[model samples]
Target: MVPSPALDTAARAVPRVRPAPAPESAPPPRRGRRAAVVLAPAGLTLALGLWGIRRQNSMWRDESTTYQVAHRSVADLWHLLGEADVAHGLYYLLMHGVFTLWDGGLLALRLPSTLAMAAAAAGVALLGHRLAGPRAGLAAGVVFALAPAVQRYAQEGRSYALVCAAVVWCTHLLLSAVTHPRKRTWAGYAAAASATCLLHEFAVLAVLAHGVALLSARLPEPLRWAWARAASAVAVVLAPLAIVSQQQASLVGWIDDPGRPELLGFAIPALVGLGCAMAPSAAAGPVPLRALALPLLILPGATLLAVSFIHPIYVDRYVLYSYAGFALLAGAGLEAALRAVPYPKAGAAALAAVAVAALLPYSIQLRTPQSRLDDPMAAARAVRELTRPGDGVLFMPARRREPILSSPGEFRGLRELALARHAVPSGTLHGIELPAPRIRARMLTVQRIAVVMDPPGRPLDDTPQERMKREVLDRSFRRCAEREVRGMVVVLYARPGAC
Candidate 1:
């Protein structure tokens, strides 16, 4: 059959009607690839974070406090926060929920931090990708997951790792708002920033870094103004929490002036970050990335350290979020170095090998019980062995009560001679102490007493109650035995000649 000449001519003229090559769309597939690139690093981070997470079956003093506080009834937690640790109230609530689901010992206690650290690594990768490229992001995330300080906190059962994760995401959200100025984006920025601050009041310092990012950004006037508004909103939302945390500032009285070694330790990361920012590849990346990363790396810790000269509020873990910036900068530096080399892929593999080799010893150390200042579990075990039914336990200087609090079961049979109330009842980390006269009176009555004290050379706590406790013990009792436990001393005293 012969087709009509007009129809045949039209079909030939239509160029075979090839369906427009499927509209050249690959959005879904492209998105899926991007998600894989981001998530693979996150998964690696999670695996690394969970490694040796039990920390050799040891619990430090602070973790013990976390365990005790988180295990409390919700009503008791609320009451306790009113008197102390208002700074950690939200974290305690989160941990309480975690323990409620699975009270599976240290694993449950430390898992939240491990997960938070993994999230932080993912955010670091995303930030690096946004600033530079995917390779840089992956490298940064890997570096962060391997950092000694990061690994240390990842295994700790505390709010610092959570704060680090929140601040990293907040930085990412700030970048998003800068790039796409919309009400929803700005609101998301505000929420992320607020969450960071709420996680730990010290994390509010990260806002200064965000300000640096905004100021350096080449965004339009309206976007800049929107950022300012968002920053103000975050500040306004967190004001009450700041005020409450400040009221509890005395809790940090134990932080002494950072020594030379500590200062040098902090300087290493800051110097490395600054060097990366000043490197040639730093110019190749988005200008705002260097601006953002540099300030985030240096400002929080530097500001805290400078202020500590007058008020002494500096603690390394308090500014753990700064490490994220260090990771990003290190990633950029490595990429820059590799780009300059003759063979980039080989260069990258070599650099990574060097990093792992350098960090291996420290990584191994981080998993040991001696990694911490002292093992509260060890002290508690010693106390348990020394104690007898009806004997009294006395915490010298009051703060030494940490071991007892950590292993409450071990000390259950012994009376707490100076305790005014239990921690939950007294709304304190260590229960409130009885009056000096009462402490002395109780010490006199006990036929045998176990004393938990700090190692010698720790400046003596000269409070009236501590003085009274020493006076009574010296006058009425003779030392029967003294045992040195890691980070503590346990001494047994009995009525003269009773030993």
Candidate 2:
């Protein structure tokens, strides 16, 4: 990388008229450029993550899961992972350590994601700078930081952002190994790749993307085989996790088969990435941006989507690392677009400013609790305000119990009609529920019941016990009052005219 920088610095250091070489040598200027491109977007990402760090003190269903799981005893967490969410076990363990150091509620839960996203931004800058010039690198970092999906996940308390960060940095290592070709570098690549896949099993798809880049670049036989050995080692490391996660595949059973909207989602981005990659400047190097970026941008999503037809496993976040590839191409394309004009640097700055201005509305929207699918914290507040003494509680699909899982104090006054065991005890996210017959009998015992459910138009649970919950509540209890939370519903039901 040092010698590569000299190539760019040689052109810039062509005996400038007024500049002093002592203060402005190649290394110093290069160091300044590196910090400028890397830190600028990283700072912006941190700012975005911090701006609405709390989401008005709201925690969504997923974050609520993270809160409860991370707070669990290590033994319980380990046990729970085997039964479900084995793929995310590594992340849960990481967050457990995070909360151990500083259990600052939402801040503690989410700060790691914020930091991970910032790291991801820095990695994107470095990768772009290595392939193209510093301007392209700066552009790529900014593009990644400003992506709506990146912003959404940056504040999320989940493995996706960490996976994104790990994948980006690991891809950078892969590139480094292409040039440096040392045994130690390959070892680092394997360690990084394994860590990324461990964050989420689906992240192994990134290996396929890396393989494509290696094939397309037409590197020497030794380098190619080294990547294969490294990739093979990563696969070996992840094999156990893959097997475990497959057994837990029901965790993602909620995903629908890919439809027109889903097709369009990948198609639009694929076309744009292809266009940007075709630009002559974007594809100029030993490992050109297009050679890597096109495959990285397309392969993961395409593979996942193609596999989704057989197993229904496609989701945008599952392939979130693909966004890094898109950002790289876009940044290079932006620089190429401006290359024909005079004062290209000025043009790039103006374009970046315009982009910030254009995306202002979306940036503001990303901070709100409403931006998420559901806010369990808001739903908890609804449950707290509506419950009466001796009232029974029910979660329509059982998983709707997410609101009170982290804040069990709210469960104190209300008796849970269907619960047979608590989450930690049962090794489940939502507590296990009684059979349909028992649930029916229990619902009849309470004078009033409070039910937590999904928003209207969301799919209902088709399980028999869930059906019985709805049937008994509707037939035996009359709706007294109801309120809508950001992403869920809370309804109070009374026996006969008790309301």
Candidate 3:
């Protein structure tokens, strides 16, 4: 109270203190909101996948193989893998477990694919969010769910969808590892990559993309070394499978060189993805996300396509995981466009409308019987309607037996003229074929024969047995009727007077 005048003057000169600015690194809002954004796309994918999961009343040729293989006992499956379809052995084993739990019907068979697709959708969203933002993630996930190709595989009973899911999550894990550079994160990445390759050996191509991403990131030396170690481990683990599958590569001998239209189909989407990744977007953070997305989207398909010129091993389904990268790029592009528009919400709505409009017709067509190469059930029914109890059924080329194999009940009374052993007994996707002499002899004994064949103009099977079948049918029988199913021809041949 009695302080000197000098002290009072000093107190008056003191500057006022300001409150501390909010911490720039305050913990992010509870992750629940972000999780919701990612989960929403997953939910959409699940709904779309499940909508017509069981609608395709019949299994196609490939699904028929799955059905035949999955229905076999574990011992038989193991034995079959040693002889054929080693590439698909793991998937067949998985389906065996699924069927064991619930032998409900096609629903049980296809549900796993549907669920895997949904998981892939969610992974795409999360990966997009990590690279770009929430909006981009959401858009990417929606785009993925609506993709006709993705939807097609999602409803099928096969391993392609699972491979896609594995690749998506593996990409996400790669992003995590690069950012954190932790042992646990890299381990997760390895596990994901391994699972992807195990689902389908072709998926090992994804690792090339991962390597590119790691190199482009320019991480610390320790992190880079860690990635190399992790990648090497994955390769070592996958080598055995790759070698075995290579021996059975003949299983894919049917895949032809892709034509101009097919190349265009693949190029268009990949170009779109690249364009999106290159586009300037503040929402898409500055780690050259394009470097990551581009390689994943383009490398696998391009490598396969190029190699196919030499080996004819290219098929779209084998590299379906590339779609995830495309979806991520598309989502980012759509979000960037929406942000640029005067009315962001309206722009987003319009974008979604355009996507739906573009996809609806194809989606509708996909649900019909004609969407697939052939409806096995339809072929079986057609054969049943045309044949008598004692008629002999012959699958020309032998592999054409898929339809009948899928609907064994329909042809119960008819003799399989050239079958030396049934698929399960023979431990083969189709079945063992009789010798040429045996086939001809069997054909001679039957008064009426029903032939299951490939469509006209398709290359005919020229095996000796097939040639003999043709010769005997032409010389001893008259063509009574012929019908064309979606992807096959059903011909009725009878003794000249009997017709």
* Top lDDT hit: 2
RMSD of 1: 3.3
Off by over 4 Å in 3: 1-30, 283-287
| Sort order, lDDT high to low | 2, 3, 1
Per residue, candidate 2 scores C-alpha lDDT tens digits across 1-499 of 3567868889887976895557444467778888999999899999999998888888888899999999999999998998999989999999999988899999999999999999999999888988998988998998999988899899999999999999999998898888888999999999999989999887888888898888998878888899989989999999999998889888888899999988988998889888988776744457988888888889999998999899898999988889999999998888888897898888877987898898889888888887888887777778888887799988887888888897778767888999999899989988799989999999899999989998888888899899999899778889988989888899999999798
- lDDT per residue (tens digit) for residues 214-276 in model 3: 677665677778878887888898898889878887888888888997699789998899788
**RMSD of candidates 1 onward, in order:** 3.3, 7.3, 5.0
> Which candidate would rank higher by TM-score, 2 or 3?
2
By summed lDDT, the worst window of 10 consecutive residues in model 2 runs over 19-28
Any runs in candidate 2 off by more than 4 Å, and if so which? 1-27, 282-285
The CA lDDT of each predicted structure is 0.84, 0.89, 0.85
Q: Which portions of model 1 miss their true places by more than 4 Å?
A: 1-33, 282-287
Greater lDDT among 1 and 2 belongs to 2
Q: Worst 10-residue stretch by lDDT in candidate 1?
A: 279-288
- Listed per model in order, the count of residue pairs whose N, CA or C atoms clash below 3 Å is 0, 0, 0
What's the C-alpha lDDT at position 63 in model 1?
Answer: 91
TM per candidate:
0.93, 0.92, 0.92
